[model samples]
Target: MLRFLIIAIGAPLFLMAMPAHGFARLTIDADSQYRYAQSRLDSGAVDEAVAEFNRFIHFFPADPRVPQARFQTGVAHFRAGRYQAAAAIFNQQTVGFAGSPLDNQAFFMLSRSHARQGMIEQAIVDLHNLEALSSSTDVIDQVRYELGWLHVDQGRWNAADQAFNRISPDNRDRFQVANLKQSLALSGAIPFKHPTTAGFLSIVPGGGQLYTSRYQDAATAFLINAGLIWAAWESFDNEQYALGSMISFVGFGFYAGNIYGAVSSAHKYNRDQINAYRERLNQHRQISLSLAPSPKGAALCLTISF
Candidate 1:
């Protein structure tokens, strides 16, 4: 009876333990794979991390960790500067993991990828969609700030102002917004030479170049035109009609070219000044966004500096 009791109890225990061991082994394998992939990413082994993430997704589609894995795959692409690929991955996650906590982050990453690729319109559209879809104030504020900066890059001053205005005054980005507005205003106020006026002034040879403040060019133009005119007149007085005609034609061509060149020069001068001003403004008006820790796992944060 004692032997029978021991066998009976040990048999059931063995049966339960066998299945538990199998389940534990499976769990360990899955977790190990996930951690390995994470470590690859942390070590900047982007390709290896992406491949590992793909394998994990394929093997454990239903796992709760799958969404994070998918997101990390996109991040790996982003870190490698494969922006289009990153965008594709992030965009898919937005739909594939709908309602997941990583949804907003995926959207933001998609927008940033587009922006990095110089697809400003697409970036703006993505940001707008993020604003509409996310209820998080932090996400919305971050999107607005991004929109503002994009507008500033495109020289859409009014649009930038409007975008910034939408952000609450109490938000930390308000000071940055003010600085951006001031920079835009100052850039717009930079004086530029009027092309039409420069052309008018060119009626007197070299006048247009002078008006553009190119004194050396103006002097060169005046000297060349005066010499050519004098040469043509002297040729005509000496009864060298053919030579005179040739010289006169050349002088007239130079005179007309001078006028056109001055107009173009003035326009170019204005453009150069504007570009320089923009460069200076850019140095002082950079805004960036990144992920930050939050009570709910992660959130977007905007950084601005001069």
Candidate 2:
């Protein structure tokens, strides 16, 4: 009789475990979606890949894979050169899941997005945060290098120099070393006043790089500027630079280019300090909590009044 009773009681318990196997079905569904989407992505069927992922997100809203999908969506946007959209998505993820395992990865993507938009400071901040938060020292070192280079792009010599100096010798990335040398060279050129020319070049992208003695950057800016000026001169004269109008325009380009270099260098330096703080926050796992009993006012009640 006892054996019979045990079997009768166990029957429902065994039956109840059947639905628990549903996760396997869900796994198949998600896998199928991922594979289909990957194929679309590979074949350059961007719209199809996006639609498939969107469907998966709708079905598995609470799944851990949501972040990964969101990140992939953001990547697609980035690859498509939709940087503003990509930055928005990545930034949302970084803030939305602050302590999640995906946080570091999100920040890494954010840095890339900001860079694409030419928002160098914000990108540098994200890079520093990624360096601090991730477990890999190698990743941190690589970000440190990138952050330093972004600063160089904006013409911040002092900050760039300090950032380079702080790099761990063991993790010395050669690419970063070369950029640091470049930043240093530009920094050496920033302190003279050619205000009017500087102001003009500063307003134009890539002008500062040339002003601070970054030859490649200067050539790029100079050529573009010269072309524009030549076009304007050509509008009025057949002989471009031989004309007074063309000569003045040519002179202005050189002047603007030089001034832009100094200011850009200075701006980059200030951002490095902001980036360092962000890195520090990630390096340490910080929390503030008081040790007290679980119930509210437990500490007060336990203590007797004197």
Candidate 3:
């Protein structure tokens, strides 16, 4: 009686699980499944596309298209701004699918993922790794171009110029790189105000702020210092010696602060100009990679407009 009760209780649970197990085993056309996932991705339904691609990968793990599906999944995540997820997928593709046709692409995408998340130092390290491993002229040029932009973002102007200079003369982006180099050359003309000069000029109580083009702050500093000095002089003229001394002490504090603030404003002005120049240098920077098959073999084609 006990054995019969146990079998009856287990039978329904086993039956309920069987259909799901069997459905996973059902024969499906791998191409059609991959196409469905691709269609979802193409329609801009990123979340649904991720789900469908995951489904295809789950059902057709052995299909040749599985690698491409995985790559597309990473692309979908990247497009959705889910950079960490995309990085993981691309990183895994580089390792798990070693020697596969998409290896270089996976590595590049991994670096891109890191870059998008502001992990710039890590991204640079990854790009250096990619550059060292790649033998293709086109791929190397593309990597250097990206490296240049990364350096520009970090304010490493000399490093950026070096990277851009490494691109071959025959490459299509040479003109664009020349334009970038021209921009870098103009960086010196961005109207830098020396902090020391600002401090020295502040002896006149707002001269430094004027030098830095902070008109309103210059006016305010001038008024405050002038008022304090006038108060001290008036107190001394009235024969209030103690009050005059106190006023002079207060005026000195304001005068010293004016000098410090002027120096700080000069530094800030320089930073603002550098930041604006960096933005200009970065305006046209974009990199894309596509795999193309030739009669001899497959190669990665990297294209950059600037």
Candidate 4:
């Protein structure tokens, strides 16, 4: 028979009275590994902390602490701004270890990770799940706030209102959430910059932007274009056209970025407006499903078709 020796946490250090006490059995030195990992973490050596914890997990694959180790690993990745890594780890834990003690926290973290990565729709789904899973008042409050923010970002004012309204008084004091709610209450969006001007500028080397009302884009186009103008002027004035030419070449890059930004913003604005319009076209469907009898205790069955 294969014997597995395990070092359990919080277990009594009593001498074993086995007939054959020797190094013949496989021993799991978890205590030492845990201590070393804890020491590294306390020392602020994050890389070493991961290394030690990884070793601990490798040595004790089936230990009860595995879930905790997984959570810590995800946390470490999150602290490092490795959001994709954190999301993957958290997602795996949430799906693979549903009943783990850290599942709620992991799901919350996964939502946050997706938010940071701008996976807005995915973030909303996870946030919704987190809200449902949260038992703590504070977490519930945060879920409402983040849910509101997600809807706001997507330009769903009615949905945003619903989410924001769910915020508890106790959590209303948070600056970020309060500010967002206040802004949303006052105006559904930050500011309405005319996408026409932005788009026009892009279409006509910044002229369209000026017409559409994108002053910033107009300025960028006008300012960045000086290279060609300067080059021509320099060549005309002092015959040192090479410097002006090089500067103009660099100016082309700035012009390109500005144009791209203007065009992108314009299209995004159009999409937003279209979405708003389409939202108004939504129709409500109601279907009622209930058991009813024409006569008391009669054996009657009915099916309604829509």
Candidate 5:
């Protein structure tokens, strides 16, 4: 009885331990690997997360999560400030899986990447594409909202207003839209100096600079030009033809430069005013988004404050 009992227990134990020696490796499945990649990303191990995500995509191309993995990889690149790479990946997501639930989100992200790279027109185009393709109100609203800000950045106030008007009344940023309109109305009053007017006024030596509010430059320009003209006239009166011609030539050069400088100063003044206006409008307003990996799919989360 004792021998039979020992054999029964030993046989079961032997059978249980056999697998360990049989080289049956404990393999991580797609879900576990994907979760690991996501955890790495959340922890700010961006490079590692990208590698792992690529691995998941490469090994589990048949898995539905591959799309999410691809997206997460793009998110990783985006978080790392590799905007071009992020854009490329997001573009693939948009093209490779057209009409998928993630399509709008991918387009939005791709546009964001382009915007970050200072490709504003390209970003606008992508957003317009997303707007046309998406049926979801939420997606359309997001696209229009982004389009409004982009137009604002480009100083297209009318276009921005149109974009803002198209957004649904239920948009959370409706009150902020009112503030934007108020600011846009004030934009007309922003100080501006016309380059052409400045150039034309420069015919009077220092008049252009004075018009542009460059008092010191105006005085300097006037004094220098007056001195050169006086010297050239004196040289001519003294019958020193060579000296008069040289002085006159140099004065003419200065005169031309003064005109060019005045036009440039006007442009600079306008730019400064526009930049300041933009700064005030952008102040206390922001919009940002990212893709969050999940078991079901990737969630595009937008955070906005105005």
Candidate 6:
């Protein structure tokens, strides 16, 4: 009877100890994995970090840090330039973790990833959603500013103006908006060369190039066509009909090419001027927003504004 009682008591104690020991081991493993993943991410081993995060998420689905793991995975994809994948992950987080603290951040990252991929429409949609969902005034202002900048990038000046107008005059971004307005006005006033006029001027061999301010090209075109035409005339006068025909054919080609080249150059010149102006505008815009690495060291923060 004594041996039977001891066996029964020990069996239950052993069963209890087994589960406790297993739980302890699992916790230790989870902690180690989390730390290792974070270290990998800090070291810029994005792929390895992503893999470790995946492993942790798979094994510790109920862990409180799972949300952070998912977010870090997306950030890893973003750092690797896998924008579509990053966007997908963030999009999922936005929906799956709705009302969670990470939701707003995920939504913002989703928009950024979309923007990086040149999916402007999708980015704008996400930004609008962020605006609707966020109660933060700063977040709303950032959304509006981003929307305006997107319109600027697409050269939709009217749309950009509309977006900027949404910002209150008292807002800190007022100066930036004013600068953008000035840039838009300047762009409108740029005197672009007419391609038709350029082509018409090219009737005089290299006159079109001269009109486009391509002085060296105009000189080169004029000399080449003039020399070829003179050669053709001399050959014909000497009764070398075949040689004269060849020279005439070559001369005509160069003459026609000059006309076409002049038209293209004029159009390109206009584009270049516009692009240069826009580049300066972009530089000024960048000065208005400050970007720095976030506390996580995995993403950037655009919080401080000049």
> Among these predicted structures, which one has the highest lDDT?
5
Residues 96-213 of candidate 6 have per-residue lDDT tens digits of 5354346766877798799889898999999899888877666567678878877877767778778877776666465477777777777677768889999999988789999999
Q: Report lDDT (CA) for all predictions.
A: 0.81, 0.61, 0.83, 0.63, 0.85, 0.80
Question: Model 3: per-residue lDDT, tens digit, 160-245?
Answer: 88998899887746438878888888766788899999999999999999999999999999999999899999999999999999
* True-vs-predicted CA distance for residue 98, candidate 5, Å: 7.1
| Candidate 3 wrongly placed segments (more than 4 Å) | 1-33, 96-101, 172-175, 235-257, 283-289, 292-306
Error of 3 at 24 (Å): 17
lDDT string for model 2 (1-306, tens) is 999999999988888887885445535477677668657766777767677777778887876566667766776676677888888988888775444435655676688778878787788878877766666655566566656656655656567666766667775554345444553655444344343454466565456655544567666665676666666666567654456576666658665654555466545544554455434322322121112221122121111100
- Model 6's alpha-carbon lDDT is 0.80
Superposed model 1: Cα runs more than 4 Å off: 1-82, 96-101, 116-118, 172-175, 248-253, 283-289, 292-306
- Give the clashing residue pairs of candidate 2, or none: 155-264, 155-265, 156-265, 156-269, 197-256, 198-259
Q: How accurate is candidate 5 locally (lDDT)?
A: 0.85
Cα-based TM-score, every candidate:
0.69, 0.48, 0.75, 0.51, 0.81, 0.76
Index of the highest-TM-score prediction? 5
Q: For candidate 5, lDDT tens digit of each residue in 137-174?
A: 77777788789888888888788878877888787474
**Two-way TM-score contest, 3 vs 6, winner:** 6
Clashes per model (N, Cα, C within 3 A)? 0, 6, 0, 6, 0, 0
Name the lDDT value of residue 12 in candidate 5. Answer: 88
The positional error of residue 63 in candidate 3, measured at the CA in angstroms, is: 2.0
